[model samples]
Target: MAFLELNDIHKSYFLGKEEFPVLNGIDLQLDRGEFVSILGESGGGKSTLMNIIGGLDRKFTGQVKVDGRQLDHTKEKQLDNYRRGTIGYIYQSYNLISHLNIVENVLVSLDMTTLKGSQRKERAIALLKKVGLGDHLKKRPSQLSGGQKQRVAIARALASDPEIIIADEPTGALDSRNTAEVLKLLDQIAAEGKLVITVTHSQEVANYGTRIVHLTDGQIDGDTRLKPAYPVPQEDQSEFRARPLSAGASYKNAFKHLTFTFWRNSLIMLGTAIGLFAVLLFSGLGNGVNAFIENQINSMVNPNSVTVFKNPTGKKMSSTELQQSMQQFANDPSKLLLTDDQIDHLRDLKHVNKVEPGYQLSTYTVSYNKKNSSGSGIQTWTKAFSDNTIKTGHKPGDNEIVINKNQAIALTSAKNYKKLQGKTVQLTMQWINKKNQPIQITGKLKVVGFSDNAQALAAATNYHTMRQLIEKKNGVTKANYVSVNVTNSIYVKQVAKKIQNLKDNNKYTYGAITVGDILDTINQYVQIAAIVLSAIAGISLVVSALMIIVTMYMSVAERTKEIGILRALGERKKDIRRLFTAESILIGLFSAALALLLAYGFSSLLNHILYKIVKFNIVQISAANIISTVIIALVISFIAALLPARRASRLNPIDALSAD
Candidate 1:
């Protein structure tokens, strides 16, 4: 048995129904240390035979035995291992990756070996030095001369230390002097006890080898021995060996390619960033608007209180229907009033700190020194009113009342509106008793405070003071509404739900409303607007995804030849896929970072401008939004790369190496 054997190999190409044979019934036997030259004409199957031996052309019907172990050509994984471990190819074209420098080009082959970090670099440097190109480690392929390029190719081929080196016209593109130097290098490679097989058409090239096999029309016409084979050396016992390419190597290569054309990729990144920025900006705006609205409402009313009213219909009502029900109070106020039993029940509820029975008249009037101002939303003061509501003075006490800026300026001027404070005014209100009869309640009160808050727009007097005035006017003091104060703000919602769920004979007895509920209704609209804006941003994101897809597809087309080289160097399908996918992911990450910067920068400026007018920051970007942006970017990139990367990985090495 020989070290390497080809047994009755046959390969053919079909053009429709016509079969064109390239190699027919070929049988050869050879051993290591023999530099064998298969000399033939251009179309006489010399290169095809080399491809069969190198494991790059596996579709042929043949049994390639190395050291008596036959290679199963049909198994792609097996062929990949055979090429990765035993075969090294030196192409005539010097097919070096354009983006990689000299040392890096050699390291591309060494990356599949088990050599660790610095060990691989050290070996690649040593190989480049051995080829007499030690000072040109950083130079790219285009910067090197023809002879230097061929030397780089030789270094890369020998990087993995394979058993057999296949040179297909290694000196074909070189002058006589450079050709002599390259042949001397090949002779040195054979002298090192490894099998060297060169495919050539030159008779002088064949004579330099140990044996010359003259191939004519895919058949051996002559076999001549010029010199004996070199002695086989002792097997290397080192643990170093070839393995599959790791994901980290794939990512590193991807990044190298990305930076090689950074300017072109930057456009894709900017477009994606703009789309992401829209999402982030709108999300922040929603947050800011929600906070501002809550702040405005909280400044006028207490958060730890809920209003309890008689549920005359004894059913849950939407906010719209509830507002309509309040309008019904003008015709019959008694029907909207809470009975004494309801007030006591509210006071006894859990988490209830205090319960105040209040009166709300639909309309009221205040006359001071013959100047009158009519108002609505007239309600007695309760715990529901925040202390901050009165910007000028204290809350109404005893015979005192608080008036808003509208009425104060109506009675007095805006500048002298403060003068209305501490001035006596005649307050008159309309209401109804339990008998369903209308009545008039009038009292002479002194204004103590003035405000511009929404809740204090209409004048408010203390509950006890209003009750006294109503009694004095021969009117029944009905409790139209009850303000229930919770022990803590957190308990407001829980207690309110209990009140709204309260039943008397299977019918709800009370309706509860809180500041949080009102804000929640308002926040829904805010969220809808944010979603609409985000949805529009999502349209741009779709376009971004398409952009990414087109970019990856273009990359696959541009790097098709490189893809072929990598596959010939033993890269797996998944590694090729990961290469492209990793680059796209980098694009996504950079875009996300850019979007975050844009969002924060614009938000800062917008908030600064709006804060002076509204007295609040209106754009608040949260940590959650940042994380969501990153996740969206990654998912989009991964999904976008799937098709292009798959197509790139599936390309045929023979055809790919031939691609322009």
Candidate 2:
């Protein structure tokens, strides 16, 4: 059997439902260490024949054997191995990676091989030296002359030291001088005892080969052999020669290609960064909002306190009626409304603090120096809900009453005089008695302190005790609101439970809630807002991911020839896919990191702006944002790169090499 043999090779194509034959039962044979050339017209199957021999184009029928190994209809893995270990392919386009140095370009061929990095580098340098490219090792393809690039390509083809070197129009893009130099190198390669087969349209190229074959419309038209007048002696083969598994070669090729094009992948990373930034921005903002709400609620609440009140009522009664009813019910002897007995019982619970009783009264109209105003009309009335334990106000005296800032403001800014601090104010205490009489008492009370925030009164209902007011307003004894506080915040619920147990059969009934419940409610609302913001960021991320996919696909189209050259030079299909995929993954990881940093910066900027308005310290970042952003970026990148990587790996070497 010949070293490389083709027996009746046949290939066909389809064009609009018509069968077009490219190769018509062509047969050829090549011996080890022979220079053979196939010359043909542009449309002829010379390059196609070379592709079949190179293990790049599989859609053909023929008995193609390399060193007695069958090639036609071979398994994909076997074909891949053959390409990696036995054949070296060079193309007319040079196919030098624009971003890689000549030596690195050559090293790419050993990616899947068992050779380590140093070994690969050594081998690459040796091949470059052999191809007269030793000085140009660090030069990119664009930096080198046409002839120099072709030499680098030839060196890359020799990286794995394959048994056969298949050249498809290797000198097509070169000038006469470069063509002559490349042809001379081919002769030297064959003289080194490797089989050199070339497809070309130049007569001079054909003349350099020991055997010349002509193809017309895919069929062999002329076959001639030239006898050498003087044959040269064979060179010694005691140098580097070994074969590793194809899997190793695939990995090596992927690494080599990725290293060469790493810088170009930054653009994809930028896209990923944009997505990550948006996502982290919203997530961080959400966390900030939640924290702020919690702080606000906690500061206003006594951590160990529980307040008892009616579950929200649906009545829209006037403020006068509400205040009167609350005061009347709380002070009523007939209705037990959280009596002193119930307060003492709740004091026995673990971690019980004070368990102070409290009440609220609204719409108590006051007149100071002819100025008249109602208590319910005050905005800060809620601050007065706290008991005297958290405040310094004295209990209501006979013919005198005390009120919060809301009430003080009402009395101060009534119709007449503005100053009512020490002035006597006429306070009208209205009540509905057992007889349902609209009884009103006019009392003279001194103006006291002003109400601040809700946090000033943690126990509730202590602005001025209603006991004196109830006594003054005869025939009305009742109350509406009540509050309780514990010794320890951790045991606030224990005290609240004791308060609830005081219910059941008691006339004094109420609902109960701890500080934790109030803060929890605020936090829940903040969390919901965060989720909404994060979702908005996610939408932008999705768009960025799609953009990456589209960009990568365009990259694949641009680098089709590069992929073909790599495959012909012994890179596996998996390696091609990995090169593209790695490009995308690197981009994503870079973007994720960048996005996190940007988010941090953006949050600081946003917080500064908010501080000017709200006067509060706000934005904060966490490790969770980093982890989540990275994971999301990786997933988006992998998903986006899937199609482009596959398409790049599946390209037909013959067609790719032939494309302009």
Candidate 3:
């Protein structure tokens, strides 16, 4: 049986209900070891017949049989397998991918083969050398002459070792010498026991083959024999076999194209990078701001200290809920006053060293010599106040108080501020009793020193001294809060959790607040502001995504022919789709890398400027932030390429291969 046979093939084109027949009832029988030229004049359907035989035009009514087995051309997968495994196509226009070098262009075919990476390159180089273009392996088609480009195309066609070779107008644009060289190569290919078919209008090219089949207006009018077919030779059965392109190869191709157009893509990367940079920068700023605030507060407060309060809700609350309850408790201090049992429970905590019951006045005032220094915050001294907070003198003892440094300086002259220590001052505040009756409390206290910090800007005294002054008056008083000192800082949270979980009458009796908790509350607001800014900056990513979409669509349009070439070379639709997506993802990754650089650069400069004033680093990028930026960039780029890649993948190979 003939190695390849076409039976009763008919194909037509339709334009608005008008039928134009291109091929009519074509019947042919050809075997390996023969160079068959389909000879015809213009519009003789020579190329059309070649397309059908090559499995590139499967829309026609055709029963194609190979090696005594009929091919199911109606099935796309079958046709793809036929093209990739059995057919090798050499085009007149030398359809070499513009972005790929000569050797890389050949690998486009070899990548479909089940060959090792090294073997694919080695075979590609061998094929290029066989075609006498070994010296031009690194050169692009643009750098090669017409003949050299065609040689590269020939090398690419033979790379995967297909059974049949189809050359369409192979020497239409070449000189006589180059045309003769190409014809001789076809003869050599046939001599290797491969079926070679060439379609041409020239009789000189026709006679160069072993058999000449004369075609007239889509019909074979005559079959002429120029010479006998070459003798069949033993072939290597273990050579690389053609298969579907793998995902890795698709990505490799995409990367090659990406680097080939890096300059144009760099602009797109820069635009996308700017958006990622903004988000990362703001996130880092939030991180730095939180760190700085926590550091300052931590430095001025003892971590081992947790302030215990009477539970207003009698239930655990998240940090956000606890903040809302602060004002409610402050306005009604009578409700927040802790009983003796609650104070004892805090002292009973396993890790607790001591518990000091205290009162935090929402409003208080100090007057010395008819001059007043008023404050909205006044808390009795506890271990929560670090020794570093006191700028001068020692902690206030007995009936002595330490006020805000700025307020102390305001009431007394700055130079004599230290002299105010040991001077008697009148402290007064309004408080609510157990019966909710408001009463005025006053005390004559001596100033011991001043406390200075962002958080500690208030008047304070020993808890017992404040309790004594309030009790000495005709008003009833209670401990509004208790400061629990833990044996170690590491156990602060564990001990605090225990205190907060303590219950009375099966209801939560107390809540714990620590310096870290307060800092966390402040950081929450900072985080929100950062997120809002990042979200605003995220708008630019949308624009960048649109840019990517536009660029990908433009890429599909530009690489239309390359897509056709790949499809003709047996690439699956999925491979084509992934090819473009891989390129977009590369764009995204490169953008992320660029964004990381930009974010770090800007953060360093901003922190440098900020540290001089605040004495703290105010912009810190974290690992999580960097990772999020990369994932976001990839997702955006992937989503942006979907439609364009789909469009590219669904294009008709016949139409795409014919594109200008």
lDDT for predicted candidate 1 compared with the true structure: 0.89
For model 1, how does the per-residue alpha-carbon lDDT over 233-262 read when each residue is reduced to its tens digit?
Answer: 887775589999999999899999999988
Q: Where is model 2 more than 4 Å wrong at Cα?
A: 26-31, 39-44, 72-74, 175-177, 191-193, 201-204, 207-279, 309-354, 361-451, 454-464, 467-511, 527-546, 569-598, 609-613, 626-650
- Candidate 3's C-alpha runs over 4 A off are 312-326, 329-332, 432-437, 487-501
Candidate 1 — number of clashing residue pairs? 0
Clashing residue pairs in candidate 1 are none
Estimate, for each residue in 550-613, the C-alpha lDDT of model 2 and write its tens digit: 8789888888877777766656677777777766776777788889888888888989999998
lDDT of 3 by residue, 1-660 (tens): 899999999999899999999889999999999999999998989988998898888788978899999988788998898899898899999999999999999999999999999999999999999999978888999999989988998888889888899999999999999999999988999999999999999999999999999999889999988899999887667566888899999899999999999999999999999999999999999999999888877777888899887788888865456557867777677778787877876666798888888888888888988898778888889888888778787888999898888777877888888888889999999887657888889999998888876256577899879989888775666788888999998898888888777788888887778887888789989999999999999999999999999999999999999999999999989999999999999999999999999998998899889889998889989999999999999999999999999999999998899998
- Give lDDT: candidate 1, residue 69: 94
The TM-score values for the models, in the order shown, are: 0.94, 0.74, 0.95
Model 2, C-alpha of 296: deviation from truth (Å): 2.6
User: Ten-residue segment with the worst summed lDDT in candidate 2?
Assistant: 377-386
